[model samples]
Target chain A: MYKLYEFFASGNCYKLRLLLTQLNIPFQRIEVNILKGESRTPEFLLKNPNGRTPVLEIETGKFLAESNAILFYLSEGTDFLPTDSFEKAQVLQWLFFEQYSHEPYIATSRFWITTGKAEENREALNQKRAGGVAALKVMEQHLTEHQFFVGDRYTIADIALFAYTHVADEGGFDLSKFPAIQAWIKRVQAQPKHISITQQV
Target chain B: MYKLYEFFASGNCYKLRLLLTQLNIPFQRIEVNILKGESRTPEFLLKNPNGRTPVLEIETGKFLAESNAILFYLSEGTDFLPTDSFEKAQVLQWLFFEQYSHEPYIATSRFWITTGKAEENREALNQKRAGGVAALKVMEQHLTEHQFFVGDRYTIADIALFAYTHVADEGGFDLSKFPAIQAWIKRVQAQPKHISITQQV
Candidate 1:
């Protein structure tokens, strides 16, 4: 069986779990408390030099890191990842956008705020607030015209973006302004195998 | 015919040009001077709402954005992209690494320094310096053991990384310590149809 080294609360980890559960693929979930520095331990480092959680251990020794990369790998040969060339690129476009543009601002703010670390770094939080809002604006604009992020289908791109976006309010981002995104969240949640962010494996 | 909306000096844009040249794929280059806010204009926003350059006009009225995503799209079915599932994910892992870990530090530093803006943000440069060093160290450690990033063969993973890495010195990063990366740079250049970063389409 595949093993997932993950922290339950992390959206990055959740993206993989959500996809696996949707596909009904079986995998073991090993909790790694990042807040406790468990991921930085030497043995974990041996598993992933990057020292990150949500690592997919293909077997005893083989492993894969990076949440989006894992999503791409697991979604292969499935309808989750679009096969059309332009659609594939667009899926990847959103994946990169999620990492570079969206997650950095939205997820970072959520981590800092929800963990009660927001008090110490008001300046940093303020800085991230604008960027997080900007990312949402981009999504809001796109979600308005299209139900999903790519190919008008429920795809990995939606899963990748949804991981952080649905819980964006936890990061202190108000979702009230984005009606399209609000509806998209419900649409995703209404899927046949939809799972909550807090759901355990 | 394909058209690339790009800024000549951007390493992100350079990655696509480099690959197209190596693949011998013909494309028209339409330079968008980002420094002048060209990318942010309404016209460009229609092409890519993200308002970033290196937008690939796959056909009239159809476009794709994000540099790494474009590379993946153009490289499909070519030897540049790995065919195996695990290997493709490995390539993506590195691509994500290049964007999140490597580019933000190394590429941003280069932009700030070379554009005569480094003086205003010495603290930011100093902040990036450590992260940039950390990224390079990771590359050095990996390259020391393996000849290429994902598999032994050259792939778009190398091209994505090479875009910024080859000119990391412009960012005030010292590559002298990374003997393995230095050697890999020479190896990439030694490949057939290799083009310089400044080479026009």
Candidate 2:
């Protein structure tokens, strides 16, 4: 059986859960409370040296960390991964962008504001927001013209970026500013088997 | 013609360039100096809104951002990307780890020391280094038994991690601390088309 160790409200964990639901995959949910430092415990750290959440443990006891990785794993051989070589690479490209560019700005800002740490570096937070909004605008522009991030259909790229971006407002980002992103979010939500983060299977 | 817009010292660009060399793919290199903020110009941003280094311009002038994406594009349909679904996901898994777990810590620490930004946040810098070192230890433990990152083969996973890690000392990381990684670096360098950042092709 596949078991997912995750923390609710974490964009990273949410990405994994969303993909599993979209694919109709079955897995047990193991909650790790970041607030209580459950992930940092000796047992959890043994499972993941980095002590981060959203680890997928296969039946063989092998575990996979990193949300995007889990998405790729669950989405493999499915429509979520493009067959064309270049398009497949494009999927990876956006996934990397989600981590390096978008997540750093959007996810961090969300973390600070959601956890009430935004006031300490409001100026820096705003600067990151400017950068994050710029990133969202870039996505908005591409998404406005294309149905998916890489090709004509939904891929793991969309899943990876969709995690934090859908809730970017919690980080004090004004999603209403980017009409294209708003529409793109709707398109993603409209997927036949889509699931929200708060859903229990 | 396929033209690669890149900075000399960027690991992301190096990953692409190294793959191009390995594949013997013909491409022209156009320098974008990150230090001079050339990537942030209107002309460059038109190619990639992220304004980051290593934009791969395909034959149709279509620009591709992110290094791993470029690697996957250039090495498409080749032996570089595994055919098995799980194996392919494993590659993505390592690549994702390179970004979230390894890159943020190792690459950022290296950049901090290389560009003399370490003084700006010495405490935070040390934290990143500590985290980066912790990550390297994971690699060390893994490398102690395996030659490549996953499945005993040289894949883009190695390329992504090798980019910043080979020059970790530039970021004030003492390579001598991790003998396994040091040996693994040599193993990668011994590849048929291995290229160094300082080497001019």
Best by DockQ: 1
Q: For model 1, which pairs clash?
A: A110-A171
DockQ of each: 0.87, 0.71
CA-based DockQ, model 2: 0.71
What proportion of the real contacts between chains A and B does each prediction keep? 0.85, 0.87
For candidate 1, what is the DockQ?
Answer: 0.87
Q: What is the C-alpha lDDT profile of model 1 across A98-200, one tens digit per residue?
A: 9999998999999998888999978878989888898999999999999999988899999999999999999999999999999999989998799998977
Most TM-score-accurate candidate: 1
How far in Å is the alpha carbon of A14 misplaced in model 1? 0.5
The count of residue-pair clashes in candidate 2 stands at: 0
Q: Candidate 1, residues B1-201: lDDT per residue as tens digits?
A: 999999999999999999999999999999999999999999999999988888999889999999999999999899999999999999999999899889999999999988889989788788888888988987888899989998898999999999899999999988998999999999899989999998766
| B-chain TM-score of model 2 | 0.94
Number of backbone clashes in candidate 1: 1
Off by over 4 Å in 1: none
Cα error, residue B188 of model 2, in Å, equals 0.9
How well is each residue in A19-84 modelled by candidate 2, as lDDT tens digits? 888788888999999878999998998777678888889766588878887787787679888877
